[model samples]
Target chain A: MRAHAQLIFWAVLVAALALLPPVVGVLHEPFYVELVRRVMIFAIAAASLNLILGYGGLVSFGHAAYLGIGGYAVGILSFYGMNSGWLQWPVAIGASALVALAIGAVSIRASGMYFIMITLAFTQMLYYLGISIEEFGGDDGMRIKTRSQFSGLIDLADPVASYYLVLVLMFGTIYLVHRIARSRFGMVLRAAKSNEARSRAIGFSPYSYRLCAFTIAGALCGLAGALLANHTAYITPDFMHWTRSGEIMFMVILGGVASSAGPLLGALVLLVFETLLAGWTEHWQVILGPLLVLSVIFFRTGLAGIIPGAGDE
Target chain B: MPPLTLVFEQLLNGVQFGVMLFLMAAGLTLVFGIMNFVNLAHGSFYMIGAYLTLAAVQWSGNYIAGVVLGLAGTLLVGMLVEVVALRTLYARDHLDHVLATFGLILFFNELVAIIWGRTLLDFPRPEWLRGHVEIFAGSRYPFYRAVVILVGLAVGAGLWYVVTRTRLGMLIRAGASNRTMIAALGVNVRLLYTVVFGFGCALAGLAGLMAGPIYAVLPGMGEMILIQVFVVIVIGGLGSIRGAFVGALLVGIVDTLGRAFLRPLLATMISPTAADSAGPALASMLIYLLMALVLAVRPEGLFPSRGR
Candidate 1:
């Protein structure tokens, strides 16, 4: 597909998501709103990860650390009686960015197996830290008493409104990532990923660019974490489990990696597949596991690769 | 100050923990270093090892026999996995290895859960191995745990001898540094890979079975200890057995000692309430902080393999 076609595909996706709530309402299937809302939140996370994993070539197996940080930022603040989105959400993003900065700065010094192991080890560190803290529900986690308040700007308590809010944010996240992929900075990031020594030789130090990209991805994922806390009305250290990070990376890969439409499609397909399988049987993962193996073996290009504008669109 | 006996006892406990971690990490890092293949499903071998031991024990009604059968079963499973799923993956990138093995983890976890029932099972030790032994003036440690340490050290020594003195170890060393040269010299790289992977599985199996008698055999139990083993491998340097041994001991002792002493130490330096909370939190994160500092200072690790 041409660039224009790709743009249209994204535009159509957002438009359809924008209009999904009313259709569900007419069909008396209000449950679909929550389902899609959950998908959007995950989609945001997957897309952010793609920025680093796909575009930046930093295989951060610890992305869930941001999710936990973002979530706990909300959960802890709420525990202290701050329900304002303005205060809660920004802190979530900022905290995750800072943590990401610290983690990335240390891990990025090494590449390949060292990098993967370091990222994973660091996340486990946070997981243990989360479990040790006694306040704000510790391992059992705590409930969010209320949704983020906007002072009469828009009521998030309404499912439709919450759905729309997630939809807007998801769409914006995907678009922002797409823009980043095409920019000079994104080029440097991609260049560094493909050939770091070459990029460095050509007067571009890939370190700062990679770190910047990593931080941006972390900050974006933090927002998704905050949204998730609101959506679930609960927060737990389990959010940062390596398995969750794997699932997000799976979505990025399952969708066309490093593409605009890949994560949205991938998240939708995976969640829906999981939902249907879950409804069918309790041991659905038994089937899902082999299917993932087959996909990795066969779907070399991912679901997005099957479409036009497959490579880095 | 903490009691001398208590500290001495904890030190022994830490060494025992390190011994078990060494068994698991040595093989994992060996395979990782030699084949350049990342096998995240190594934990599955551990799980399968525990489960198989349980099944074989119930069927044979003999503890030693069950352990032998369990190790054999785990080794066979490892060989099969390498030949069937992992052989083709050698040509692919690391990401593919990771993802495919991850899928295998899901499959194996579910498979174990399905076959064995999704509940914890008790692994009974032999009659003589059930009691405690006095190792010091005022303390006695669990006999089985002490056995675990002894058995672990003996195997470690055996492994060291084989890898350093034996012809097979030479080939392994040769294979790690230069696969193409070995393959060109008529060595079957494929067979070597399977052998190495099977060895890893057997070692992991041993760790699992020994651990079963100590902790209840349960699904997903391997994952909990696997990360710590990973920390051992990273700190010890990837694919280095000596590194694994040193790394495991360092992590186990540091972790055990930190959890034991951090609270009292923190109380002396800070407020009691702050120490109470911060101590455990920092103790848990200590290994990771150590890892980060290590990686930051030496990316190739403390014992980087010679000649790449």
Candidate 2:
């Protein structure tokens, strides 16, 4: 019964998010529409990270690399005068998938802290590469002259349309992730996460499962990245920095690791805190830093843990 | 103008950079080896050291006094942090340690920015250390760099002696090799952790002081160098000082030499424009490439500690 209430609570929250832009429009808070859009984009990113980080128990410190790759896909394509969303979005997803596959191939061989450092190094490599691409505006980054042209099917140029598109995609991603997590493959991944030896003894090789998850996560985040570039109409190497990865990781942990929908809550809370806190003080991280520390030290289950019996299992 | 002279001078520069890395990596490795704790905020200590040194220098009107006070301050601060924040994290998972320390890093970066402002602080080379010295074949080496290398080597030698000879060093090695065994022997492991952490902070501070004259003393400086330090520790072999020394020197030389020479070499082979972009890009990636190669060949590092 409590589980049903928790589920209803989550449904209500997601519904409120869906209704947010209209509500904000009524309040003349156009700024919040942009903020909510940003939150939804990152919600996709964080949820993608959850597949590998929370479910697979792989702490990939270079997840931001996918964001950069995806964003750059759109940015670079648009720079070359191609703005077709159909073309750019898939390219972003494909490029990120390939990179994730390659990085995962090597990184998966190493476990524990080595895996963390290796993933970070790979992202730094990409970051430096981004800076060296003089043709693409290099370290300064590039502005999108126009949003990804959808050939007038939906007109992404319309803010309301773009907002609803992002909102819908985010909902789809969360639903898809929930289904995957309950599937047989996700169970194997979870099994691998808890005890690799036991899983191996049972003849389910965790390696391929993990690699598949990593690739999917990367592709999803890449999609988010493409949206992000359109949403902001700019892309920079700064997007791929390891600290951004840290922020995403913080969202996963802050909301509740290994729990479906936790990353959404995490993303929502973090974005709200950042926006509200930064408005008050330039040294907002001074407050944020301690909050993260205190949370880790005290609330091992994250924000979701606050829900009675939610992550108690 | 002579290629030989350029190589010779750049080699010395590499060694200087290597020495600086060793100071940072040694402390990092020692803490990791002895405590099995990952401290992402180690770089924050490096930043603190540099800022404190700069502040002290400005206040005291004397470089030597500033160095002394800064080192002392960093040591004290490191111990205080360990006692206050890190001790609670000892029993937690590695992820928890990473998250908490990362938080510490954010806190320190913000605090420093608030206190000192975000702009880079000017750290001028002292008068006696400003000029270049004539070396092999009349090649010129900066006096400051040469001094840095000398001091680094001296410290490395001292660390070697202490680790291989002293009772405290013996305890540290023992702790790394087997923590429970040492605790079983009734050693005050907690106090030892504090001492080791403090010593590591001092070494990081020393590196910061040396680095201040070369790089801007500013917020987030520690983070910039911390990646390289992590590379050093990983390449060297966690919990092994010898590994850190070799790894630091190798990374230092390779990085400097690659940046200095790779572009020119590439230009000779490929088209100038191709070389122009590819050279610096590849050069920047050299250390990470080297690390990848090492990990691929030996995941435990070049010299992982024994009997873990």
Strongest candidate by lDDT = 2
What lDDT tens digits, residue by residue, belong to model 2 across residues B1-308?
A: 33788899889889999999999999988898888888888888899999898899899989999999999999999999999888888888778888898899899999999999999888987887899888765888999999999999999999999998999989998888888999999999999999999999899989998899998888889977888887887788877899999999998999999989999899989999999999988998899889888988998789987864
lDDT for each residue of candidate 1 in B248-272, tens digit (9 for 90 to 100)? 9988898999999999999999999
Residue pairs of candidate 2 with colliding backbone atoms: none
DockQ of predictions, in order shown: 0.75, 0.68
Task: Quote model 1's TM-score.
Answer: 0.97
> For residues A6-93, what per-residue lDDT tens digits would candidate 2 score against the true structure?
6777677778877887888899988888888899899899999998999899998889999999999999999999989999999999
Per prediction, fnat is 0.67, 0.56
Clashing pairs in 1: A1-A309
Docking band of candidate 2: medium
